[model samples]
Target: MNDSSADSFSPRLLRQAQEGGYRLINAVSLKEQLERGSIFLVDVRDRADYEAGHIPGAICYPLPLTIQARLFKRWWLKKLLCNEGCTNVVFYCQDVNSLRSDSAARAAVISGFPDVYNYPGGLEDWVSRGLALETGPCCEPEHHL
Candidate 1:
């Protein structure tokens, strides 16, 4: 974790947080879940990216501030509204290489949200696979860490 004076992500810390908590999910599995029962999809990308286009039903949580994850020195699990979760929760961002999804999933786990899923392929994969995206605003974060 970096000090608040810094905003860089530490790979080692991210790995430590993930441990056995994060579940790696692909576009296929994500889409299937999206079509079914209670599932919370959180898009951890910047707000603008989310507005441009995002996975349908995703709520924006932005980044850095949401997780702390100590990737930013605070990892405030207590601040997350984990009880608001459904049967499953998935966190996602730009694509495969982004750490945002990993950090967000870790946060959900620490907050005690069960069945946390991390979609590494995120919006890019959703769109690339010819899936539909809801263009306008769907939901936003009412609270954050």
Candidate 2:
């Protein structure tokens, strides 16, 4: 098995991630977020991967480059977020290290959203727990696949 930081789900490290302006949500907390209906869930993976499966209701937008390069193609993305009045933006990707997902969260911060977060375990974790997922275009051409 490939060793990864995601395997080390530590309370102390989670606290540090929070302090560094990144929120880490577990299956339980993620469930709570869904129940509350206050979070904007962003999947930072390619289109094919997303279509194969993903967390239900997650908006696929890829990451960093996509967010910067194709605003018009993803207009509705911003529109929904605007309507949600959401304070938290959650980003997730396939990689457990989630460096890309973390970068996406940082982009959200740069875009002026204060409560940006990262779900490092991503769809891997979501599916492993048997959480239902939604499938569709979910993203723009910028997804690159």
Candidate 3:
């Protein structure tokens, strides 16, 4: 994993993400959302971490690009997420307290996604809960690239 000073999760950041309209979703809730379909699940982790394992059906849209898109290329990111016909857009990361995922969720809201959620109970929580995971390259490379 590439370690950067910014790669840290903070409670204050989480609070800001929540204040920005990112609802928190637990692992169980996330599982239900997945089963219900029509939800755009985004994994905002590194490519290697995503490729190694992730919640089934999640597309890799790494945090850096997500933040950049949100800050500098808002319309492009907004169009990409909104045009997908999903009822909701959800983002997750390696851990529940991940600033990466929280930031992505905040970005989604900033991009005008009304129904954005942050699965703070992220991959670690999912795995700990014994939820099944999928491994391989993301099926939707367009989202990641």
Top model by lDDT, which number? Answer: 3
**Worst 10-residue lDDT window, candidate 2:** 70-79
RMSD (Å) per prediction? 8.7, 6.9, 7.4
Ten-residue segment with the worst summed lDDT in candidate 1? 1-10
**Cα misplacement distance, residue 8 of candidate 2 (Å):** 7.4
lDDT of 2 by residue, 2-48 (tens): 11244457665476466556667666567678667877778878778
Q: Using lDDT as the measure, name the better of candidate 1 and candidate 3.
A: 3
Q: Any residue pairs clashing in model 2, and if so which?
A: none
Clashes of each: 2, 0, 1
Ranking by lDDT: 3, 1, 2
Error of 3 at 104 (Å): 0.8
Task: Find the candidate with the highest TM-score and give its number.
Answer: 3
Ranking by TM-score: 3, 1, 2
Candidate 1 colliding pairs: 69-75, 70-75
lDDT of 1 at 114: 62
How much does candidate 2 score in TM-score?
A: 0.70
lDDT of each residue in 23-139, candidate 3, tens digit only: 666666678778878578988888889999999989877666554554643445566655645557888898855677777777777777868877776899899999999998854
lDDT of 1 by residue, 23-106 (tens): 666676677777874577888888888888888888877776543334542144324434443547788899877877777777
